[model samples]
Target: MIKIEDITFVAAEAYKRSGLVLSTDKGYLLESRLAPLARAEGYPSIEALIAAARRESNDRLLWAITEALATHETFFFRDNTPFDLFKQEILPVLSRARGNMSTIRIWCAACSSGQEPYSLAMILEEEKARLGGLRFEIVATDMAPRVLEKAKAGVYSQFEVQRGLAIQRLVTHFDQSGDQWRIKPNLRSMVTFQKQNLLENFSGMGTFDVIFCRNVLIYFDADTKKRILQRLAAQTASDGYLIMGAAETVVGLSQDFAPVEGRRGLYGRSGAAKSAAA
Candidate 1:
């Protein structure tokens, strides 16, 4: 039997390795997530599992525990409003401003299972004419190696495809394979997947013109969020745009990026941080 003390320790360890804050509300989270992990490693119960995790420097086991805790819940073109905002507003401004520099780079930070970046590719394809002469690539990254592998494989089950993806796009961009759908080579080629820990240094990652860091910062504590925002500010171009989750805000978190005027869930590093709210 896994005691409450063991569950608390597990949560602490998860945070140390990955900065994930386990919700106090999920009472059965440890049992639901760690039980299978324990059984797989030949432990009798969650108690034995966590006992071993506490004692040793087992990198493999440690990662397995973290992965179980990490949420991989995501889908294509999630929250339609943002994509529309991108096409109708952000893209045009960026296109005109970056006319001299024909290359554009977008970083899809914590891009779980490839959906978000691929969604960008589809929009890029659809807007190729309007964005004439511009060359763009998406650098999609996640801390979880397992999810990154899934993203790189570019395969999705039927249920995953049905979420937020239109039939036209599904037929136009994916090929059915057995019981799964595989993203076409052309679309898959537009993104490069890498394993990246957001809490760590972003060396060699370079600056980005647009960054989609949605649904990620909400899980981090305040200090971590501040550090990440500062790093994000340094890595974004002077005139870049950042998109966050609908429920997230940088208002009091960091002064580097301000919420763009008239756009919810969007922030811009455009001159002087004028839109920064107190």
Candidate 2:
């Protein structure tokens, strides 16, 4: 059994590094997730691993702990509504507003294992003729190096592809290699994946016409959520949209964005923002 003190340390360290809250009740997760890592690192137990990590101040091990605790629960087009809204509502609006000459910039924050961005890429491909020659740039970012590597490879197992990926899309956008499916080179090229931490400054990453930060903020505390929402707002174009997970919202947490009428999880620059700009 993992000790309370060790659980506290792990929780605190994870929050410090990733802004992920790990309450004491989640001690079981620490044990289950970190056991393999502990054994791999030559520690007899999670306690010893945490002890050594603390004593040696091992940044690598600490980061491994954070990564292990991170919820990488995602699949291609995980939620159908968001993608439908993007393809049906968001794209038409963007195409009309920006015209064919301008490119649409999309940032998929915390995109896990490449599914989310790839889903968007597939939509763009399907709608290419409809878009009137408008170009698109997709930048996908995640905090974990391990997932980013998998995302860059553009490969997924049979089971992975089965989740949320239609057989038709699979046939069109992927080439079967043994038991794995590899995303077509053209589709893979549509997204640029990079390592990014939401806790850090986003000034270098310029504004985006659409930001998909879905299902990410629920892991953080209130302050952290507010901070991330504010940063996201700053990176959003004045008329751009912010799409979050169904469970997350800008209400009470931030005044930088307001919900797009009748659209769940879709937000635009708030009235307060407009007044401030005016």
List per-prediction Cα lDDT, in the order shown: 0.85, 0.91
lDDT of 2 by residue, 1-278 (tens): 88888889889999999999999888889988999989999999889899998999899999999998999989999889889989888888888879977999999999989999999999999889899889999999999999999999999999999999999999999999999999999999999999999998887999999999999999999999999998898999988889999999989998999988777888888862321111
TM-score to true structure, per model: 0.93, 0.96
lDDT of 1 by residue, 44-160 (tens): 887887778778967788888888887788999999878887788777777877794488899999998989999999998888887888889799999888889999999999999
How far is 91's C-alpha from truth in model 2 (Å)?
Answer: 0.3
Given candidate 1, what's the lDDT at residue 133? 88
Global Cα RMSD, each model: 2.7, 2.9
| Model 1 TM | 0.93
